[model samples]
Target: MLKRLLPVSLLVSLTALGLAQPGGLTQTLLPYTLQLNPEQFEQQGLALAQEAAQLAQFDQIELALPRAQLAVQLAPQSAKVWSLLGSLYLQKNDLDQGITALQKARLLDPKSASVLFALGSAYFQKAKYTQAVDYLQAGLKLKPNIPGALFDLGNAYYMQKRFQEAIAQYEKAIKQDANFWPAINNIGLIHYEQGEIDAAIRQWRTAISLDAKAAEPQLALAVALYTKGDREQGLALGEAALKLDSRYADLKFLKENLWGERLLKDTKRFIATPRIQASLVRTPQPLLPRTAP
Candidate 1:
C-alpha cells in the first residue's frame, strides 16, 4: 500500500539529504585513512567568538567590545560578528564606530533587513532624521512589511510636525498588523490635536483594548475627557494614570485644571481699541507695464 511505502520513501530521502551523515559531509567525502585531527585553532576561535556574543547580550560592554574585536580579527568575513560589534558600539554611544561596523556588515550582506534597520536606528539616534528617513525608506521598499521602519518613519515625520504624513504612515503600519499598539496610540494623539475629540477617545479606547497597560493612551484619553467636560470621570482617569506612573508631571497640571485651581492664566490681555479696518493684505505685485515701443 502507498501508506506502507511512504515512511520508507521519506527515510531514503532524508538519508540522501545528509541528515543521516554521521560525521558530516567533510568526513564522508574523505577516506578514514586520510582524515586529520580536528582543527583545534578553529575550534578555539569559534568558542571565543561565541563567548563575546553572550557577553554582549548581557550588556558587558567593556569585555564585549574587546572580545568582539578579537572575533572580527579571527573571522574577517563574518556578517554576524560585525553586526554584534556594531550593536555593542551603539550601546557604548560610539556612533562613528557603530556606523563603521554596521557598514561592514551591510557590505557582507547588502540585503539584510536587520543590518539596514540597525543602521537606520544609529542615524536616528544621531538626529540625522533626513538620513534616517532615506535608509528606513529603502529598507521598507525592500521589505514592505517591516514594522520598525514604518514606526520610525512616522516618528521622523511627527517630529517635523508633518502630522498628516505621520498619520498616513502609522495607518499603513496598523493595516499590516492591527494590534500594533504604538501606532494605535499615535493615531489617537493625532486625532486629539486636530480637535476631533470623540474620534480621539474612540482611538485611545481601541488602543487600550489592544494593550490595557499602555500608559500613554490612557493618560491622553483622560486629558481629552477632562477637556471635553466630564471633569469627575476625567479626574479619576488622570489619578489612575498618575498611580501607574507617579513621575508624570503633566498629569499634576491636568489635576489642577480639573479641580478648578487657577494654575496659570492666559497672559495676552485683549483690549478692544476701535480703529478703521483696513485691508493690509499685500496686493499681488502689479505686473510691470509693457515696455513702450
Candidate 2:
C-alpha cells in the first residue's frame, strides 16, 4: 500500500486592512491576491490525487477524473499523481489516455511495479498483447507476489495463445492467493479451449466453491454442464448466472473474457435456450463495470 495524502483546503489571501477612498469613506473591500508556493501546489495536487483514489474506491470514477487530471497538471513530476490519473482513465474506459498517463508515470518512476502493471492493463485493453506481456512481466519481476499482476500477465499470454505459459502464471497467482478465483476460472477457460472439458469443469467448480457469487465461473460451469447433457441443471445455473450479471449473456463479452471458440459455441447454445433468454430480459442489470484482467 502507498502512503495516504489528505485533501488540501488552503488559500493565502493578502490582508485587506483599512484602506479608505478619496472621500475618507471606508471601501467595501480591496481586490484579493492569492498565490501558492511550490510546496503548496504539490500538496494540493497530492490532495486531489487522494480524493480521486477515494472516489475510485467507491466506483465514482466519473467524478474522480477531473480531479486526477488537475492533479497531474499541478504535480506533473509526481509519479503517484500521474498513476492515479492513468487508473482513473482506465476506469473510464479511456485506454489511450490511460496509457499516456501511465507511460509518463513510468518515465517518472521506472521501478514502480504498480505503474507498470497499469500500463500492461492499458495495453491489454488496446489489444496489444505483446506490449501487455512485456509490461506485466516487467511488473511481476519488480514485485513478484502481486497476484493481480500475475493474472494480468497470464491474460496477455493467453491472448497470444501461449497456453502453457498462461496456465503457469495463473497457477502461480493461485499459489500466491489461494482464494483468487479469477485465476482458477481462467485456467478453466484454457482447459476448455484445449478440449479438456472435465478438467475445465473441475476448475470452474473449484472457483465457484471459492466464490459462489462470481458470475464467470458460474456461467462457464453452466455452459459446460449444458453441453455435457445436464440440461436442467445447466439451464438453471445459466439463468442464475445471468440474473447476477447479464453482460455474460453476450458472446462478444465472452470473447472479451478470452473464451475460445469451442467454449463459445457451447455458451452460444446455452444462452440461446428460452430459459436463459427470458432470464436476461428480466435480469435488471445495471451498467457494466470495469472487468478484471
What's each prediction's TM-score?
0.64, 0.84
Candidate 2 lDDT trough over 10 residues, lowest sum: 11-20
Tens digits of lDDT, candidate 1, 1-293: 11121133333433453423334435565322212223432343455568878887786789878767766654667787888889889888799999999999999998877788788878877878787777778788789887767887886676556888888888888989889877877776667666677987898899989987765567677766766777667656655654554323233443322211211110000001111011111112224321110
Scored by Cα lDDT, where does model 1 land?
0.63
The positional error of residue 162 in candidate 2, measured at the CA in angstroms, is: 0.2
Off by over 4 Å in 1: 1-49, 55-63, 247-293
lDDT of 2 by residue, 1-293 (tens): 32222222211111111111122123534333334466755787788889989999999999899878777866889999999999988877889888889899999999999999999988988999999999998998899999999999998999899999999999999999999999999999999999999999999999999998998999999999999999999999988888888888888888888899999999988888888878887888767644545
TM-score of 1: 0.64
| Candidate 2 deviant stretches above 4 angstroms | 1-36, 287-293
